[model samples]
Target: MTAPAARSLVLDAQALSLLLRNDRQMITRIEAARRTGVPVLVSALTIVEAVYGKTDTARLHWVLSRLQVQEVTPADSITAVRLLHDAGDLHGHKYAIDALVAAMALRSPPPVLVLTSDRDDWRKLCGDRMQVKDV
Candidate 1:
């Protein structure tokens, strides 16, 4: 028999970007991962990052409706700020948003895993404290 899914999966900005761009490899992998009941999660931050302007918004909404989305609230933002602190200086940009996302990946008894293509900035912030994969 096929092996059961042994991991959780959360989509970061890049993963959504890949899906938006219709990258065959990324789509295939994401599809298989979803088909197998992987606990996929996406943050509002990732959604905003993926959607971009007007045109992409429709597509983003359509995609989001079909996927599993986890909302990042004010409290989540606050906590993320503390966790993301000292990682780097978060200016007027999406730092708080990212922090909330990082927090989502660090949830309760069984935390969700993160799927990202960005191996530089955000990953450095969270590190091994988060179960993030480059896939």
Candidate 2:
């Protein structure tokens, strides 16, 4: 049987940080997706989470150059609220970025895969709609 088509790769803050630092495994994953022509996505908020005063501006720009940065619209924020609510005990202050990533993933095509260090949170937020792979 033919292999399933590649799913889009979505990066959360942790994964984005790894990529920004040129982590080998993260680069491998991103390169694989690029070679396969599958889109790699990142929420605009994730950039804010990943970048900081200590962040290397040149490296940050280089890492972001390869991925699609999805804007968080008002609708996306609403969806994040719903995701946080649906997560039962996952509150906004701690899980807002994850919820936003999940919301962005949901809006993308089906069979999305998110790379995150917070696998449990991502799993809870994404359910079965998207795949969560630990970074």
Candidate 2 Cα errors over 4 Å, as ranges:
1-5
Residues 37-122 of candidate 2: C-alpha lDDT, one tens digit per residue: 89999999999998879889998888888889999988988999998888886785679877877888989986788888888888
C-alpha TM-scores of all predictions: 0.75, 0.91
Residue-by-residue lDDT tens digits, candidate 1, 1-135 = 643344667788888787777778877877886787776678777777776654366766777776778887777776787766767665456566667777776662244566676655567567666565685
**CA shift of 5, model 2, Å:** 4.4
**What is the C-alpha local distance difference test score of each model?**
0.69, 0.85
Q: How does model 1 score by TM-score?
A: 0.75
